[model samples]
Target: MSFEASRDKFQAYLTKQGLRVTNQRLAIFDAAFAQKEHFTAEQLLDKARAIDDSVSRATVYRTLPLMTESQILREVDIGSGEKFYLPASGTNSQVAQVVCVDCDKIFEISAPFMEWYGSTVSLKLGLKPITQRLQVSAQCIAQRQTGLCPHRVAK
Candidate 1:
């Protein structure tokens, strides 16, 4: 959905949860939506602080679950201790994540068959599937051969 729509939804969610639309939260939201790559909570704090220096780490940690639960941010775990967050694509499309073992990079690919596969398995067991996910862990062949991860981003 559009940013305005997402903001509206987030406002509604906060209201429904008896939370206020605080400035810090808005800064965190804007910081999150501004990111193009997956980011950790610490990275989010830095961005939010840049927008509003008063933004606190505790608020960032608390608001993350609210954003994810509100369906505006997609949370990803690459089997690493720290989780990553990215803006939700706002589609019902099935997506599969391919995580690079070498550089800890994540690539999202369309996997339309996930719906079909989930449904098929559910039908066999006489159950309904609420959600499904597919993740693949692989190493970069070029990196393996050259001892360099070309996709690695400097921290």
Candidate 2:
């Protein structure tokens, strides 16, 4: 969705929740939509601060959950133990994630089967799925051969 449409939708959601549309929240929303890739909360805070110094870390933390709850953002776990946020618009509504256990590299895969599966399950359970994410964790062959992966972070 376009920025204006997203803004309007979020505004309606905020209003419905009895939350005021503060400038800090708008700044955070803009920063998040401007991002072309998934981002951690810390990265979101930095981006928001770059846009407006008055956007506090507290605001980012608080607004992020609101955004997620409002369907403006989707929280993803890529096996990093850190929560990442991605826009809920367009292609991001349904996702399949592949995490390399040895390399710690995350790959977002597009699979129509996943979407169908989610829909089928929801129908069977008589539930509606707001968002769907499938995570597949595996060790890559190269990592198996080398006994270590270059991209693996020391945890």
Candidate 3:
């Protein structure tokens, strides 16, 4: 969807959640949607500040959890000692990365592989699957060295 349409949908969703649309929220959301890369809370605040310096760090932190709760953004831990946020655009969702343990390089996959695995487990367990986010970092040298993903190295 176009950015404007997506923004409108987000605003509507927030309204449904009983949140009054504020300039702060829109600026934060706009900064997020404008960038395609994953962003940390500080990074998000930095971007928001670029657009409107009035946006405070605490506000960004506060708004992020709400956004994640609303499913407009998904939180990801890139194994870099910080969590990052990515927009959940339905089919696009949030892209997870496959990191190279040896070189510390990251690779982005089109779709999350874990969602399928989680679904399978949920069916077997007779439980509903709740996938918060998908993150695959190559922090496992053995897996990468063996040419297998860490989550699939044994197989």
Please name the candidate that would achieve the greatest TM-score relative to the true structure.
Answer: 1
Candidate 3 lowest-lDDT run of ten: 146-155
lDDT tens readout by residue for model 1, 7-124 = 8888899999999999999999999988988999999999999999999999999999999999999999888898999998788559999999999999999999999999999999
Ranking by TM-score: 1, 2, 3
Of candidates 3 and 1, the better by lDDT: 1
For 1-155, candidate 2 gives per-residue lDDT tens digits of 77888899899999999999998899899999998767889999999989889999888988998998887788887757888888876654456788787765666777778778988999999998776778899888867787767656543
Give the alpha-carbon lDDT of every model: 0.93, 0.83, 0.74
TM-score of each: 0.96, 0.77, 0.71
Clashes of 2: 0
User: Candidate 3 lDDT, tens digit per residue, 96-120?
Assistant: 6676555444456777666777788
Which RMSD values do the candidates have, in order? Answer: 1.0, 3.4, 7.0
The pairs that clash in candidate 3 are 99-138
How many clashing residue pairs, candidate 3?
A: 1
* Better by lDDT, candidate 2 or 1: 1
Candidate number with greatest lDDT: 1
Give the Å error, residue 49, model 1.
0.7
